[model samples]
Target chain A: MHELSIAQSVVEAVEKELESQPGALLRKIGLRIGELSGVDPDSLRFSWECLTRETGFEGVALVIETRAWQRRCPPCDIVFAVSDYQTVCPQCGTRETEHAGGNELDIAYLELETP
Target chain B: MTQIPMERKVLGENDRIAAALREEFHRRGIFCLNLISSPGAGKTLLLEKTLEGFAPDRRVAVLTGDIQTDNDARRLARYGFPVQQITTAGACHLDARMIERHLANWDLSTIGLLLIENVGNLVCPTSYDLGEDAKVVILSVAEGDDKPLKYPGIFHRAELLVLSKIDLLPYVPFDIAAARDNARKVNPAIEIVELSSTTGAGLDAWRAWLDRRAVH
Candidate 1:
């Protein structure tokens, strides 16, 4: 699954971040996955477990925050949450809405133990 | 016990490599396209037809990604254009690092157009950018008109939507207008092209579009 790759990316990012703080053990990883980011969080966590197994980071917590997809109506200038790819403005009934948010895949923060 | 705010992108490594690739492509004046679709969407056939149409006048090369076999690469190699296949083994999509590794030995200056046929999966490929000028999503008539809405992420990221297998429209239940409308709802600026590689229908327009964007 693509989640494996994403998990690997997360591991790499954490490893890079740890380079600055030597001997600090990773305790938790925080991620912000958007609805439209095409990532499955459950799968990511599973992959992360498999990847970190036997490593010092085993049992580390992965906290994922899911963001909802939002779109802005060009005519009505209304920003509304979208469940699907529904671009039709609920207020003005126009189909000229543009994407506003919910495409992010960021590693927000990390919790570490001072060794 | 201390929380540090990194605020870094998870795919930062891939994105950074992709940006470098994009800069290299721009410097070389090579127009690159990433073609994405589901399996059995006739991506190889369309590429074959495209190479046949663009070759002899333009320098074209291809990198096709798949989970197992390099059959698509073999099929495209018949067109006499340079072709390479990246077998993901079991991976569902192609990432920028894969492309960067594959292009390590290749010469980019001789190529005017480079078309990358991503591993056929609608969802996974959407998030991975391959340093292309455009991401073209291919939807066949056989796949139904509701695919854009069903897999909105790919449609939302694509710059062009190619409706392939128009020759089968008579037998299939696909509604082209509805597909276009759905795609537009997700991405209003996405360009649509209808073509059938089997019947040679709309190939000229596709070629024209390629020619206009391709650096030749």
Candidate 2:
């Protein structure tokens, strides 16, 4: 529902990052959105379109690299990705797993316009 | 193609604002809680009960958010506590700016415990931080037992899970054990308090949890 706001933030952040190169154009925006980020990539893409409809970012691409929920088994000394929010270790079947990662919501890179 | 590696958070602006709010809250010794849940999960009723339990002179305030209604604010005001309504118009979630704006004119020094009832949403509200000391997720027996698994983002991030509307557990097909197990699966350390706003059962335990922060 607030995807538009998120998309706007993305644009604003990119523009702020490119303040030194205002004349430089962007080709694509790479995003790393984890499964637990609570952001649907499709909805964000649609919102991106709505935001950049007639702007300089109109034709720029949004490449999203999605991630899975990852948990670390303490005794087993192993980190693994698990689906369905089940943190049970695949190797040890222990429930004492720590969250290793999967809440990523970062702008990975910006592909600038070709000369 | 000039590929610049820009590893930055998309919601950096909101996060910065939230961090500032957190610093201010910490400076003033204010403990704030952000409540997330799906619509009709009895967030308002639980808040109503909580306010009713507090003393009339308690230095507690509330900020309730809804997409369109001042009705919740009106309901929460009867307890004589300072309550502010954030009508987001059409936004599904409340950002830190909204909270900051609502708290702009208010006297923060007098507020020790601040409760923010977020707009009823299991998904969108999970990403936005409100500078609260903790995030409490509410799950009612009337909803699905698999909500913790389905909406793991919110469940995974929250510190406590309030299982509301438990009085109807017998009539509903929802499984309490499964619900608790699911919440634990995602968040092994999540504290849960089962209660019904109607029967007032387990309100003491809920109040006790609140007391740890307020009455400590």
Candidate 3:
């Protein structure tokens, strides 16, 4: 599954970040995934668990924040949340809309213990 | 116990490599296209047909991705164009790093058109950008017309939508009008092309579209 690869990337990112603090222990990772990001959170967590076993960061917690998909109508200038990948504007009933937000996949923060 | 505010994108690595690839492609005057679709969507067959239509003067190369086999590369190589296959080894999608690594020895300057056929998938590949000039998603008539609505992520990001296997329309219950409407709902600016590679029907229009996009 792609989640496994994504989990690997997450671990690699954390490892790179921890490289600066040689003896630091990773406590938690904060992630923000958008609805349109195409990442399944449950699968990611499962993959992360499978990957971290027996490693130094085995018990590290993963906190995920999901963002809703939003779109903005150019004519009406109304921003609204969208579900089921609907792109039409609710306010103006027009298809001339642009993505406003919720396509982000970011590592917002990390908790670590310094040695 | 202390929280560090990294504020970094998780896919930053892939994005960085994609940006560099985009720059390199533009510098070489190469029009690169990324084709994405589900398994058994006839992506390889369509590519073979497209390659046949290219003029001998036009320089074209293809890079295909698969989970474990080099079969696609072998198939396209018969066209006599430079072909490279990236065996993802079970990775569902192709990242920019993979493309960069595969093209390490390629002479991009001589290629007028570069086609990257992504691993046959409808979901994960939509999230990764491979630094292509345009992304095309293929949907065959046999797969039903609800695919556009069912898998909107790929359709939303694609510049063009190609409906393949039109020759099977008489054998299947597919509503072309409904499919077009659904795709338009997801992406208002998307261009649609319907073709049956088996009969060479609509192949000329497809070639014309490629000819317009391929950089000389």
What is every candidate's alpha-carbon RMSD to the true fold?
Answer: 1.9, 1.4, 1.7
Each model's lDDT: 0.90, 0.93, 0.88
- How well is each residue in A1-115 modelled by candidate 2, as lDDT tens digits? 7789889999999999888666677899999999999999999999999999999789899999999889999899999998766688999798889998889999999999644
Quote the TM-score that chain A achieves in each candidate.
0.88, 0.92, 0.87
Per-residue lDDT value at B138 in model 2:
97
- lDDT string for model 2 (B1-216, tens) is 799999999999999999999999988989999999999999999999999998878899999999997999999999999999999999999999999999997999989999999999999999999999999999999999999999999999998999999999989999999999999988998999999999999999999998885543
Q: For candidate 1, write residues A1-115 as lDDT tens digits.
A: 6898898888888888999989787889999998889898999999999988998779999999999889998778689988656667899888778888888899999998886
Model 1: per-residue Cα lDDT at residue B70 = 84
DockQ of each: 0.73, 0.81, 0.70
lDDT of 3 at B171: 92
TM-score of each: 0.94, 0.97, 0.95
- Candidate of highest DockQ: 2
In model 3 chain A, the worst 10-residue window by lDDT is A83-92
Interface RMSD of each: 1.5, 1.3, 1.8
Candidate 3, CAPRI quality class derived from DockQ: medium
Q: Candidate 1, residue B36: CA error in Å?
A: 0.2
Record all residue pairs in model 3 with backbone atoms less than 3 Å apart, i.e. clashing: none
TM-score of the candidate numbered 1? 0.94
